[model samples]
Target: MSKMDIYRRSQFFISPPAILKVIEVLILVTAMILFLVDNKCSGDLAFVTIFVLPCVVVALATLISYISAVFVLVGRRNPLTTPTWVKGDVWFNIVSLVVMLVGSILTLTNEGCANNSLTVASIALGFISVILFAISGAVTYLVLVRHQQEVKEAQRAQLNTRRVTMSELA
Candidate 1:
């Protein structure tokens, strides 16, 4: 293979998943900041339950996702071919589940703020964050799984071809 092809494959070992996890982290952090500011301005117990708690859950999930992605990337570069990406994907799904569940809880408990429109908008943003994270997680899982499967299949085909050639020569 050309140097460009080798570089591209190495890039695949890390970049995409790391970039995605970073995006998720940024969104969760933004949501948390927005929720915290809203809660402080209102000093409302309901806002704490409806906005703050959910943001905390989402942030925690995002942190988990980041760590898992790093682990996968590092593990892949090392000697172990244990396929740490699979573990990362599983953790991402778990994070998505937690975000969705917390979002649901927030929705059910939300009470209108002094400005009903503002409260609705904030909650809507939180819901969107949850959906985005979940979708990202699913897509990451599918891509990694497909790539790994293709690698395995190709390896098998190569091995089979080698075996057949050797047997014929023998």
Candidate 2:
């Protein structure tokens, strides 16, 4: 069987969340790389460093989260049942989203670019990453909501079952 089928059979590779996380990772990495290249190409260390630092931090956090997710999924571990992992994932994304948004805004307004092409490319990539993060955040929120709904439904069903058992016993 193909790798895709293996992932599906593992039962932990929920595609929506994984896809969103992967997209976030790629965009953040791309933006970070472009920013670094821009700095090197333009010889503007200070300006580039200021922007690159936050991007680096966010990108690293995203990478860690992505790796953790992949490990869990591949190992057939349910993130939902793993509170710590789930918490880390949630906070990482939240922090990454906030940092990326702020960094994008600052990058767009940043001046002193000897190479406008690199600057523009980095800034555009940052903006795109921010948008993708927002989309990921929305999707995560929806997934959580759906999970909660499912939990509630299951609990209600259990309660109904207990009620019927007690009524029959009575």
Candidate 3:
């Protein structure tokens, strides 16, 4: 691949859902750091094991799926993650919102979080992650809807550039 191909591939990471995924993963890391603090303070990983583990597992899985899907399907005209278009990311964000919210609430309600400054900061970041997940879901959904409409209109058009040009397009 040329430099331009590499640049286009990298550009995919800056899209809305990609940015949100990066932020969500970072927030989850912050939570893990707080868990480390809790481990150091209490000689145990009780709260972290209970509240943070699930979030970490789920978020990592979601991120992995997204990146893998894009890598596997970027070249084709796949609706999910083409070189020039992205769709199907909404589902991951929507699912993440629910799981992260549960984890955040569990962390917030624990007395350990209230007492530990690090825990408080961690949960706060987790909450922000929940909000970001919601926004990401909304944005991806809008992009999907617009893509669907464009596909429909293209069907109606008598001359479609994509259909006419059969080059190895992406």
Candidate 4:
């Protein structure tokens, strides 16, 4: 890669991978805060409820995704060669999107079950987390899809070139 390309790739603002990493961190922070605050106001229901469990799971997934993003974006590692658990690949984004969607809906619905400042704040933050996760997931998926198309095009071009060269030789 050119120096400019490397610089752009390494930058969080300019790099798609880095942007996804930052979004994962944002989601993690917001979801964790929401979970903690909700736990405080939610009494025993927080620990026992189905909704709260998913919030915790979303927080954990975001945390893992953030760590994986660091390896891929900052360390300049290839996600394709890495283990699925340690890479922010297409599947991870899809799973994160689904989890965030469900978690956000659960959090939003649970808002009606309680009445307090903290609970309301938790729900608001949950929405923010969901938005961030959705953006990250969608962008990641699109980028990967486009990348696959480009790779296929390159392969097809090479194959056609080889066929033409062989026919000419014949």
Question: Which model scores highest in TM-score?
Answer: 2
Scored against the true structure, residue 64 in model 2 reaches a CA lDDT of 77
1 against 2, candidate with superior TM-score: 2
Residue 125 in model 3: lDDT: 80
Q: Write out the backbone clash pairs for model 4.
A: none
Alpha-carbon local distance difference test for all models: 0.57, 0.66, 0.66, 0.56
Q: Write the per-residue lDDT of candidate 1 for residues 98-168, one digit (tens) a residue.
A: 75557645553644443444444555566666666666666666655666676789899999999999999
lDDT for 29 (candidate 1):
64
Worst 10 residues of 2 by lDDT: 1-10
Overlapping backbone residue pairs in candidate 2 total 0
Tell me the deviation in Å of residue 166 in model 3: 25
Q: TM-score for each prediction? A: 0.67, 0.74, 0.71, 0.59
Candidate topping lDDT: 2
Model 2 ranges off by over 4 Å: 1-14, 38-42, 70-77, 80-84
- Rank order by TM-score, top first? 2, 3, 1, 4
Candidate 2, 10: how far from true, in Å?
3.3
Ranking by lDDT: 2, 3, 1, 4
Q: Please provide, for model 3 over 87-170, each residue's C-alpha lDDT reduced to its tens digit, 9 standing for 90 to 100.
A: 446666767788878877876777646677777777778788889888877876665566567667868673566655655464
Tens-digit per-residue lDDT, 54-83, candidate 4 = 556766765666566566656665442234
Q: List the residue pairs that clash in candidate 1.
A: none
- Candidate 2 residues 1-170, lDDT tens each? 44333224254445566677777667767777776664543455666665677778877777777777667766766554455665666666677777777766665666555346776787777777777676665655555556667678989999999999999999
